[model samples]
Target chain A: MKKYNAVFACLLLVLFTNSAAASSSLEEYFYASGKIKVVITVAAIVLIGLFVYLQRLDSRLKKLEKNKIEK
Target chain B: MKLWLKILCAVLLFYALLSSFYHPLAPGGLTVDIEKLVPGANTFVYSGYNTHFKDHSNDGLQFFVSSGSHYYPTEIIEVIDNNHAKVNVVLPDTLPSEEIAFYANTPTDGTVYIMKPMDISAFVFHQNYTNGSVPVKVANDQHQNFGYPFQVIIFESIRNLMWHVPMWFTMFVIMFISFIQSIHVLSATGRENMLDSSMIYVQSGIHDRKASASAETGLIFCILGLITGSIWARFTWGAWWTNDPQLNGAMVVFLMYVAYFILRNSVNDEEKRARLAAIFNIFAFVLLVVLLMVMPRFAEGLHPGKSGNPAFSSYDLDSSLRMVFYPAVFGFILLGYWIYNLRLRIKILESNEEI
Candidate 1:
């Protein structure tokens, strides 16, 4: 509890001190010069493909878990 | 899963992913060179975003300085490229407002507004010519074509809606299925007598497996949603995480499910574990609803669909977006279910070995 309280206070101090400084640098990443359709499509496909791969890995892990439990 | 359903999910997701990039946004924003205007002839370099300005050079392209309900017309000097132009606006003797917004209209490009309003009174000069009255609202000459709405901050990141939002939607759906299976597991105790003893035991095991498997798949979706959401937030909100009600609430919900997994591992008795986990699952789902959906709308947050921010439904997800968005939602949900089924099958095989 004492550690948590100290960490919380540190966070509060950082947030207050950084509030004004944070607004100076605006986000400019992925601005895409007004044309981002290709980027969007590519990102969507990659993420979807990645999730599919994860699902396959999950199934394999489940199979391993089943085998270990059975043994 | 049915073979046809699996094929449909694949086809629909492929279609949604491909079709989302096909539609273009309507010309709805302008980037202007000058931020301050004096009472005289002002020539500002205007750049159009997601607009075909060169194509509409033959049509009447006009500019305006507009206050509430009134507009002062400007002269278009030249078109530099397909998406850049120069316009000249002559300020009158008396200004309509200290700050006025810029509006541009072309027959092909519809109407576009500068994201930032220019201060007309920033620089003062002698008033030589007085325009008698500010021109009232005139009907836009150009007909708007079907396209995505161009917003300033979320100009392109608006596309994140199709990918990010559907993740949570799919997660909720899978979690709800787990919740239902958990309830069934709790009630299946005495109902076991309705079937053969061994068959009833298998049925109860199946229920337990399904409940856990769905929760597992839901966890995967939840994590993906958070990752995708964090990327979108970094671009638009300027931070990976903001102190918004919705974001904090989502984090809380995710932590609760993590705790759920820990709880499942602590218990040794199968029946006791299933029962306790079921009750915890119901509680977590209730928290999920209250935190992610209900609580955010009551407080001011940077996320859309909150108290201060305008919901996207009003303007962002135009008809073209909805065409792909609805299919994406369905496709991802089906894919989640497919993953859940695989997990459930593994669980059943493990339990059969025990018997």
Candidate 2:
């Protein structure tokens, strides 16, 4: 869990710095076509977040089974 | 949790995912280049979004400048492209009203209109002025195509309806399950003595595990809903977090549930911890209902279904949107339940190991 927090902090730092840089072309790409890329970005965030949660649950379950076998 | 139900959930989710992004928006008026209307011949380039103007140019493409009940026909001087047309209309010396609306009709796009505040100071407003000499044909038929309604500023981001809304709905369902389990825990404990047999305590423990597991799953969905809603608010409402009553209410509910977990972890004794958490869960659920459901309706907020703004049911959630939205809601609820089921089993297993 601590490792995941560090990873999330690093990801947020990168995102903030990238937005602060003001990359016009990247901004233009997202703002094009009535800002449809905004929807895409939102969808990506949801899917990634859910998948990460599923992975955590899977690992925790595996760890429990390993402990049971060790006993 | 059955095989068929799981398959149905997967299929419904797949359909919603594909259709929400794949469907196009219905053609609607975008803008006109002219800012002001004059007394004589007025020409402007009319532009439309997803409209087939050029293809239907020969199909009796007509334009009208309508003020009140009178309609003055305009000539389509040029068909510039599929979505652009040059229109010219001659205004009379006197008009019934200052507010004028432009209308374009085609067999494909039906009747699309734009009513923007323009400078009509040049025309005189005679309330009884009527133009009976000019033949007016106003086609009131709408486009026969099935597409999401085109809205200004919201444009294509309206597709987020499928993803963002269902997250809250799923959270609500999961939390309600948690609420029910918490009630069961309280009741089971109430029926027995303090130092009861191990079997009754175990039963209450199972209920406690189920309650916390469901709440944990519900929290995941609530966080997802918040993140998606924040992104959507940033793009549409021009702010990541608004002072809307509904938004603040959601934040409070989130923090309250977090506090519920803290209350659970603080008490080491299983019976005491379960009773305390169950009582807190009941209060949290009531607060959730009040904050999310009851308060938003009475307060003025940027979200739809508020005090002043029209609800999505009245205008926005059209037939095309309902096709995907209902499936998405059901799919997300099933997915949430599936996750809650797994978490409950894991919690039960971990507790049994300790005993």
Best by TM-score: 2
Candidate 1 collision pairs: none
Query: Candidate 1's residue-wise lDDT over B194-264, tens digit each?
Result: 76767666556677788889998898888777777776776677787999998899899889999999999
User: Candidate 1: where is the Cα deviation over 4 Å?
Assistant: A1-29, A35-71, B115-117, B122-145, B190-201, B316-318
Off by more than 4 A, model 2: A23-29, B132-141, B194-196, B316-320
Interface DockQ of each model:
0.15, 0.66
B44-117 per-residue lDDT for model 2 (tens digits): 99988888889888886787888876788888899999889999899887988766888888888778888888
lDDT of 1: 0.73
**Mind giving the per-residue lDDT tens digits that candidate 1 earns over A1-71?**
36546865886687467544654432322555653642464365447645664656676667777778787
Give me the TM-scores of chain B across the candidates: 0.90, 0.92
| Docking quality band of candidate 2, CAPRI definitions | medium
Whole-structure CA lDDT of model 2: 0.85
**Overall lDDT per candidate, in order of appearance:** 0.73, 0.85
